[model samples]
Target: MAKPGVRPLTGWLFVAPCALVFAVFTLWPMLFNGWLAFQDYFIAERVAAWNDFANFVTLYKSATFRLSITNSLLMLLTVPIIQAGALGLALLVHRKLPGIAFFRATFYLPVVITVSIAAIVWRYVFHYDGMLNWLLTAIGVFEPGHGPQWLDQHVPALIAVMLFAFWKNVGYYMVLYLVGLAAIPRELTEAAVLDGAGPRARFIHITLPMLAPVIVLCTLLSTIAALKTFQEVLTLTGGSGETVTALYFVYNMAFSGFNFGAAGAAALLFTLVCLAVALVQVRVMGRHNPFRRPA
Candidate 1:
């Protein structure tokens, strides 16, 4: 039998390493990045001079930054599409049927593939003479070799990016919904059935309410992921065709252009936007959170 305080101290000792690592790697970098946002950082001299908020002012006046922000916001359109598709897929595969596991694995295969590889594959699919154009031509949507340049135009490129996002992420969300569905007590649905509720009514009244917390969680995750869209744009369009996202812009500013100060400012602004969106989502979705105590 140890002393009363000994166990608590031992627990804290176990936690100390993780805490130190987080402080060093996460907290320190965030603080340094915030500080760097207000300075003119010279890479060659390894010196930083105070810039009097010029970085922020320049980013605000940049048309490319504005367009990047707009494109990032536009990516939010994929959230609802992905969520709805995931839920539908979850419902379809949540049964005791033969070959169900194969279908589930097939859907989720995309989620495990490397993003660069997946994006490269999709780049081919969207190429002018790609399979998609071939299929569309076969269906009379376009003439052979006259297909739209999917990665060269603005709207088409954005749509292609959204499609890629949906394809890559929907399966992951489907797994989440499947777990949520499995956790739901079958008695509730049975009771609703006994009360003469039909399939649509049962889903509306029982399934939706029971899955509220999962729905909220998935929605928040999807929204944040959409707003942080980067790899798809980078690999697919290479920041061309007006498909540059906020994160991609920051990457270019920092790594490609060597404008670290402006990049830091853009990163901080993007962080704030994500934080605001998350807060708003929590406020709106808090009621559905199962962990919330009733007032």
Candidate 2:
């Protein structure tokens, strides 16, 4: 009964359920959120009404919103450093050293742990007068009470949050790099070696060139993660939110301040900013992405 050189409509039927679910959960929320972004929300009115661009104008005047944007951008700056570190770790572990699998597993195990659980563990480690400061004191870096304030002070607070983000995600990115490194043909590296290319030259020309896609993927992932930071800020900074991120700002605007209209606009702006960054990343990396063949 099926047409020649064509399958039945069974393929569409098979995927219908997943498509419906995606529509209900993902598509609906996004459409509704986009609609709400232009509206004023009021408990008195018990509904939303379009207020045009008033919310956006008010948001631009908010100092806290400005600060949050600065903080988010600061976290975004860490993506390159973390990605480089992950690449180095992956390259080191990609070797056929004895028990390398064990080492890989150990490094990746932390990434599987729940974020809340990891945050709790880091809380104690980063607490004032905690284990880290104790070690610092013992090493004669500072007196017992003079260690860096990982949570309290403004500058160090941002640094502490960035450090936690790096620690949690570096292993995840490293695993991706490991896969890329493994896929590289041994012949290429060997050929470079025979051409009198030293270790640095070989990596610069052969290994790194091939891993461009992985690097771009990890950088974009980390940048988005940094932009949307929330749990780490809450747990590490005790929700005082000294280094408030854009997501946290939206949350506080909606829940704490009860400024639903401004919050919606902030959320929309944040999304647009993230989208712009992602587009920029794609454009920059698309030039040399090895996954694409010349047309």
Candidate 3:
């Protein structure tokens, strides 16, 4: 007899193809990136040689690397903003209100749009003479000929990137929250209502505690996405603003600067940071999960 928890041969067969692809593509690339981190590879030279801590030294000393890391961390500050927007929107639509489906689809428009294409559209809108400036001017928020340079400057550029990130991901997380809200037994809320618990009180005491796992998952996804932001910065600011994120640093080093070894090193560090965040999330949320064992 087979073990109680083990799946039969059919299940293993179903998973084999995807496992093969993962081994070939994802695992191979990750292993290569790890190997490359410890080697010196110049574009002119076809052969890579063993490098001893040189890549790490270069990565640590590079001011651009520091700035990119800072920008990526700064972008992480928007996770709360995204949570607030997505959660509120999810709560609004989780119930079957009039035209709820339309509102959900409209909110999800940004996620469906291609990143490159959306970046271009946003770049046009955020330009000095774009729709945003026009609206502000019309509303008398800006003096004539005093439109803010949303992309040309450092602070405004970062702000624009954060806003775009929030907009693009809000609906995605909202859907996740909606799923969580659905899984919560309706009777619990009904009982609370019958017991004279107000809507706000019910939400504060019952809804939130039940959705803990989903909130953790959303936070982990948003934080990692913010850390790996690249395409938005590329098209939005021509990849030349204070908004250069960590992933862009890797791209610039490998392709533009022809320093694949150093890029690999930085990539490894970024991977470590991502892994740490995920592990912490799992540890924290596992406590609330029914499947988790008592501590």
Number of the top lDDT candidate: 1
For every model shown, what is its TM-score relative to the native structure?
0.93, 0.88, 0.88
lDDT of 2 by residue, 1-295 (tens): 7678767877789899999999999889777777777888886778988899898899889888988888888888789888988998898898998999999998888789888889888878878878888998999998878898778878878888888888888899999999999899999999988889999998999888899877878887788888889888876786553788888888888888988878878888888888898777767777664445788
Instruction: Report the lDDT tens digits of candidate 1 across residue range 68-138.
Output: 99999899999999999999999999998999999999999999999999988898899998988999999
Best-fitting candidate, scored by TM-score: 1
Poorest 10 consecutive residues by lDDT, candidate 1: 283-292
Itemize residue pairs with steric clashes in candidate 3. none
- Judged by lDDT against the true structure, how good is candidate 1? 0.93
lDDT of each: 0.93, 0.84, 0.87
lDDT string for model 3 (69-185, tens) is 889889888888999899999999988889999998999889999988898889888988999889999999999789889998888889988888888889999999999999999
Residue 2 of model 3 has an lDDT of 60
Q: How many Å off is the CA of 255 in candidate 3?
A: 1.2
In order of listing, the candidates' clash counts read 0, 0, 0
